[model samples]
Target: MNYTLRTALQGLWHDKWLNLLCTLTIATSLFLVSLASVAYINIKTISAKLPDRFSITVFLNEDLEEERIKAIISQVQKHKSVKKLKYISREQGLADLRLSLGDADYVLEGIEGNPLPPSLEIGVTRRAVSGDGVGRLVRD
Candidate 1:
């Protein structure tokens, strides 16, 4: 058995290039498989988190009256799928935009009045994370 092992080692030493190629091939395959597995896990994690971040923002017409805006908010709040509802006035929207823009708020200096319209931000509940549930809520 020892003689056979010595012969095998001698053969490998004589064909060093072939042994190196085989070793490199095995290493490369393992590296690629590991990389693919990591990517698959990351994708699954991101997709699972997508539902929690799902939301619906309804942009109301600028001419909509205060009463109509309140009515819309009330209606949206009554929906079973709605986990939370928030009303963003034109002023609030402008403020938020300014904050987001940081120093770029100067770009809006030439604009006359807040052109931004009021909007309703609705958060969907965990139970309503399904595609159909979100679609039904939007349709209704």
Candidate 2:
């Protein structure tokens, strides 16, 4: 026991720098692991708070009549993947564009009269956001 203790102490003293380096490496590795774990947890929490619904925009023909638009809306509503939907008229689209452009909207004014087409905004359920489901939605 005495010899073993003496040998152990001598080894530690002789390899003090190496031991310190190894200790620091382990501590740094542990710290990095802990930081990654915390980052992963935080990212998971933030993602969980986001809505599960995915949005899709469908632009309608510029000359579509109100009745035709209604028919299209009815057709889209039949899809099982769609959780919610909203229709935006061309004027509304233009107004939204103007709002987004701020003062630069004057550039659009000289181009044409209501050049934007009406559109439908759909919110797909999380389960339907898969590739196959999205493909089906696109096909229909």
Candidate 3:
């Protein structure tokens, strides 16, 4: 007999089928949206990882002193937008080349005295790997 807010809500609660339908519809919508959000985030993370795949070869002068190389590397590290720098010694490069050219005797023979240069593979942060940023880094 009481027509209070509680009593009115109790009437809606009696419509079990209708309430269940609404609940399922809302849950389904939420699940779809959440899945889309996760996919979008995955795409973004993969994009960031892609930058690590991009590399810049910093060729060292054949006779560059170790001190000079270290000094340049320090400056490169200080760059605000650099994410990571990986150094590859000449021996490592030669080894990698040999591994890649397995069974190619001609390719192996043609390379002499570790012609490959010691270099750093630079991976720029998401904000700095663009064409313009690469040019600026090379220029500076």
Across residues 1-140, which tens digit of lDDT does each residue of candidate 2 receive? 99999999999999999999999999999999999999999999878655474688999888788899999999999999999989998889989999999988778867868888899999888777778888899899
Q: Which stretches of candidate 2 lie over 4 Å from their true place?
A: 1-19, 42-53, 102-110
Model 1: which residue pairs collide? Answer: none
**Model 1 over residues 1-140: C-alpha lDDT tens digits?**
99999999999999999999999999999999999999999999998888788888889999998898888888888899998898998999999999999988889999998899988889898878888998989888
lDDT of 1 at 133: 92
* lDDT, candidate 2, at 25: 100
Q: What stretches of model 1 exceed 4 Å from their correct place?
A: 63-65, 126-132
TM-score for each model: 0.85, 0.72, 0.60
Best by TM-score: 1
Model 3 gets an lDDT of: 0.84
lDDT of each: 0.91, 0.89, 0.84
In model 3, residue pairs whose N, Cα or C atoms come closer than 3 Å (at least 3 residues apart or on different chains), thus clashing, are: none
Sort the candidates on lDDT, descending order. 1, 2, 3
By TM-score, the better pick of 1 and 2 is 1
Q: Which prediction has the highest lDDT against the true structure?
A: 1
Candidate 1 TM-score, C-alpha based? 0.85
